[model samples]
Target: MSADCLFCKIVAGEIPADVVHETGATLAFRDIGPKAPVHVLVIPKAHHADVAALAVTDPALAGEVLAAAAEVARKEGLLAHGYRTIFNTGGYGGQEVFHVHAHVVGGAPLGPMLSPR
Candidate 1:
């Protein structure tokens, strides 16, 4: 675990987060800044720079992250209407935290995937 990484601290219990779900390999928590009615962040217990890094270095753990996100959606009652899972890759991708994480957002209509350019 990267000592300076925020998500790693969260995983290590050094920092506090509103965790929603957890597994042997993953942790799901509520986003501090919620963009939708439900916005949760799912991350692997292990540290990885970003989604691409995680996918390349440990695909199985990446799958566990996705599975945890799905479980969060189900428990949040978003399965009927559907939910969105996002992985912001880097600076250009709007990833503020370096640690790999999946943003599971739903509970209302998210008008567009991105702003119209």
Candidate 2:
């Protein structure tokens, strides 16, 4: 993990967050700035800049993140209907934070607002 990374700090417990769930390899928390009623983010404890970078050498970790995301969506009560798992990569994809995180959004009508802002 990069020492200067914000997500790393949150994973290390140096920073406080509204954590919803966590495991040995991952951490799930409410988005500080949520866009939906059930907006949560699941991320690996290790620091990865983005999903594209994560897939290059850490496919297993990538799988873990995705699996955990689905689990959180179910746990957060979005399974019966539906939810969206978004991983914005790079600046063009709206990845403002240089950390690989899965956004599990639900509990609302997510019709046309998913496009890049």
Candidate 3:
């Protein structure tokens, strides 16, 4: 784990988070600045720069992250309605944190993936 990575800190308990679920390889927590009613961040406990890095270097861990996202969505009661899992890669993808993570959002009608052009 990188000493400077925020999500790593949270996974290590060096920094506090509203952790909702956890597995041997993954951690799920509420987003501090949520974009949806059930916005949660699912991350691999191991440090990865981003999703692509995780996919290339640690695919097993990446799968764990996806499993955790689905678990969080089920626990949050989003499956009955619907839920979306997002992975923002790099700066252009809107990834504020460098760690590999997935955002599980639901609990309401999210509507369009983007505004109509």
Best by lDDT: 1
List the candidate 1 regions with Cα displacement exceeding 4 Å: none
Q: Which scores higher on lDDT, 1 or 3? A: 1
What lDDT tens digits, residue by residue, belong to model 1 across residues 44-112? Answer: 999998999998999999888988998999999999999899999989999999999999999999988
Best to worst by lDDT, what's the order? 1, 3, 2
Q: Estimated TM-score per prediction? A: 0.98, 0.94, 0.96
lDDT of 3 by residue, 11-89 (tens): 8899999999999889999999998899999999989999999999988888888888989999999989899999999
* Candidate No. with top TM-score: 1
What global local distance difference test value does model 3 have?
0.92
Q: Which consecutive 10 residues in model 1 have the weakest lDDT in total?
A: 61-70
Model 3, clash count? Answer: 0
| Superposition TM-score, candidate 3 onto the true structure | 0.96
Model 1 pairs whose backbones collide: none
Alpha-carbon runs more than 4 Å astray in model 3: none
lDDT tens digits by residue: candidate 2, 68-102: 89989988999888899999888878888798999
Candidates 1 and 3: which is better by TM-score? 1
